[model samples]
Target: MKKTLLTFAVVLAIASASNAQTKIPPNIEKLLQKNTCLACHKVDVKLIGPAYKDVAKKKYKPEQIVELIKKPVPSNWPGYIPMAALPNVPADEALTIAKWITTLK
Candidate 1:
């Protein structure tokens, strides 16, 4: 029982550490909230859509990200449900969010 508890504690600590590493900046957090982007995406963990970090791993430029936000391609992410295109998101706000997303990694 003691061994099991110790292992659990170690796993919890590692999870916390990883979560801590994905802190979102206040400005970006505001934009995400305002645009309802947080409903589907998170900085590190997957929600309804891919995590921002995972998107960053794709190395898409900010402009490309903005385009994706406005017109998402379902084929880009297999297995996950297709992201709805956010054509209503203002271009400037989308670009701001995109620029920040590209810096996640």
Candidate 2:
């Protein structure tokens, strides 16, 4: 029974991870590329920064995400290098990306 349960748990974990993959829409992908967000962050996996799904888990409002983009809080993310503030990203684009990020997972 224990072996069966363990196998089931592992399978469930894999399924959940696979399902969490983020699929950015073309517009959102364009915004991400324009802002260079993809350089440090990925939709599903951790790169130089935390994954978008992980950010979604934080439960921040879309506006909050925009604020963070403008003024990154290094303390919020330990171990990873601090994200540089992206003042160049337009407000509309930042909010759009924030909304898309919150939709993940």
Candidate 3:
């Protein structure tokens, strides 16, 4: 528990420092937990949807990424299962999230 707390503390510190550029806010983690976003999309390996690492490989501008996240284009990824839109996710916050996800590598 102590180690967990310390690790979480370190993450919080780094996250806070990088808050302005991060798509997932501290509170968003709670929402994501409830929404189960991680079940399909992971940081590295591809699951049901393309991995965040793969999305980053496309090298989209922040705004373009924001648009993609807002309305996931099924045709763009026809062979794979189409991603559903996440309307609950606000544009500004999603933009931050996309930018941060793209920086995973």
Best by TM-score: 1
TM-score attained by model 2? 0.81
Local accuracy by lDDT, each model: 0.91, 0.92, 0.73
Number of the top-ranking candidate, with lDDT as the measure:
2
> How many residue pairs clash in all the candidates, one count each?
0, 0, 2
What ranking emerges by TM-score with the best candidate at the front? 1, 2, 3
lDDT by residue for model 1 (16-44), tens: 99889778889888989999999999888
lDDT of 3 by residue, 37-81 (tens): 677876556889887778888888888877876688888776789
- Candidate 1: segments with Cα more than 4 A from true spot: 1-15
lDDT of 2 by residue, 1-105 (tens): 999999999999998987765468899899999989999998878999999989999999999999999999999999988898888899999999999988888
lDDT of 1 at 65: 96
Candidate 1 — worst ten consecutive residues by lDDT sum? Answer: 18-27
Measured over all alpha carbons after superposition, the RMSD of each candidate to the real structure, in angstroms, is 2.3, 3.2, 8.8
Error of 1 at 44 (Å): 1.0
Better of 2 and 3 by TM-score: 2
Error of 2 at 50 (Å): 0.4
How far residue 43's Cα lies from its native spot in candidate 3, in Å, is 0.7
lDDT, candidate 3, equals: 0.73
lDDT of 1 at 3: 100
